[model samples]
Target: MRKSLLLFGFALALLSCNKEQAAGGKEFKTAYVDTYKLLEESEEMKDFTNKAKVKEGELSRELQQKAKELQLDAASFESEARVKGMQWAQLKQQELQKRQRDLGIMQETFREEFDKEFGVKRDTIVSQMRKFIKDYGKKNGYDYIYGTGEAATVLYAREGYDITKKLIKELNEKYKAQASKEEPAKKEEKN
Candidate 1:
């Protein structure tokens, strides 16, 4: 639905541009960027993906360790239940159930937190890219710069009108510069 709306709006804009050009005998410069390629090839996105993987691994290990401990405790409780009286066994069973519930809650909480963090980071990155593209278009004197892949706004563009590679290069360079600037601050904090 969103893509359809975007395409409709784009079509209207193109019609307007064409009408204006016909009246004024002026040509409009336009280009498109492939969003999928931009995101896939950008250095910032690559870094974001790597960091997310590391965090996921850390969480998985922590969860696995807790689960292992719970398993050991359950085994010990089973042995004790055979020897202990029924009342004592029931009490221990309740305690074990509580621990299991707590573990499940912990797992759910971790998953939610991870998803939230990932969403925020992804939104920020996309916002930054959009702003960068706008600035780039203005600086380069482009009349219209459309996005092509995923929710594609431009269905057909001339071969030379695809600026995906150029945008990716500029975006990566900007990301590299930003990372370099932050590196010093990170090192200072570590010190």
Candidate 2:
């Protein structure tokens, strides 16, 4: 009987505490964070961009060579057909068309490869940045967060409430650490 009474008293006390807490419920405040600048300042981003840029020339040259080869094959086909028959020029035109089609496919493939490379390199950085932003928002007790990107629709935000610079610095530091962990090739030195 004593144990039952003690348990009942504890339950009542808990209920009273809950009621009192409700009376002083903490309200969340609204604030914003800029993702665009955060991404721009990140070290991981810098490495990914630098790597991609370094490969740009090679990729372009390869594409150009492929195009040149296709053109040569097309011209060879055109001449071969012309020597075969009067209707051979018509056949040569068909060959030219096929060359154009092949070039288009090759270029598309090259573009997709480039895009995949960029995506693979940057995916982790973007994921980390998202988590960092979420944690920052919660830690700062912000009820709202948004961007100031080029197409940012949420305009007219208060100047004092902007956490853009702080977020950017933190993101950059985190990105740099992440990139260093990956040991990405230095942009300046090429082996």
Candidate 3:
């Protein structure tokens, strides 16, 4: 449904733009960007992915530690259960059940946190790319800058109509400058 709506809106825009160009007697320049190539070549995305991997490792390690502790607790309880009275064994069983439940909650918390963080970062990157593309189009006199990706709507474009390489280069340069600017601020805050 969402894809259909987007396609309809895009078709309407194209029609309006075409009508305007025909009536106004002015040629409108248009180009398409390979979004896959842009994201794949983006330095900021690479760095972001590395950061996410590190965080994933940290989370995995935390979970592993908890799992190890749980194993030890289970082993201890099993060994003591045989010697303990019925009432004591029941209490130990309840404690073990509580620990298992807590572990499950911990796993869920880790998953939610990872998803939330990644989602926010992904949204930010997409927004940044869009804003950059919009500004670039305006500054360079482009009437329209379309995107071509996995579900590419652009079936065919002439040789000069694809500006993926130039856009990627500019985006990377901007990202590098932004990263450099933030580095100093981060260092100052650490001090």
Cα lDDT of model 2 by residue, 36-146, tens digit: 777888888988888888887788898799788877877687567767876877867776788788778888887899888888768878778766766776676554455
Cα lDDT tens digits, model 1, 43-105, are: 999999999999999999999999999999999998899899789899998988998999999
Better of 1 and 3 by lDDT: 1
Candidate 3 is scored at a TM of 0.63
Winner on TM-score between 1 and 3 is: 1
Residue-by-residue lDDT tens digits, candidate 3, 1-191: 99888767876775566446634587766676778888888999888988999999999999999889988988888778888877898998898889889999999999999989997998899789877887887778776777766664542333456799999999999999999999999999999
**Model 3 residue 8 CA deviation in Å:** 18
Candidate 1 ranges with C-alpha deviation above 4 Å = 1-22, 154-191
Query: TM-score for all predictions?
Result: 0.65, 0.50, 0.63
> Which sections of candidate 2 miss by over 4 Å?
1-31, 72-91, 120-123, 140-144, 150-191
Worst 10 residues of 3 by lDDT: 152-161
Give the lowest summed-lDDT range of ten residues in model 1.
Answer: 152-161
lDDT, residue 38, model 1: 93
| Cα TM-score of candidate 1 | 0.65
Candidate maximizing TM-score: 1
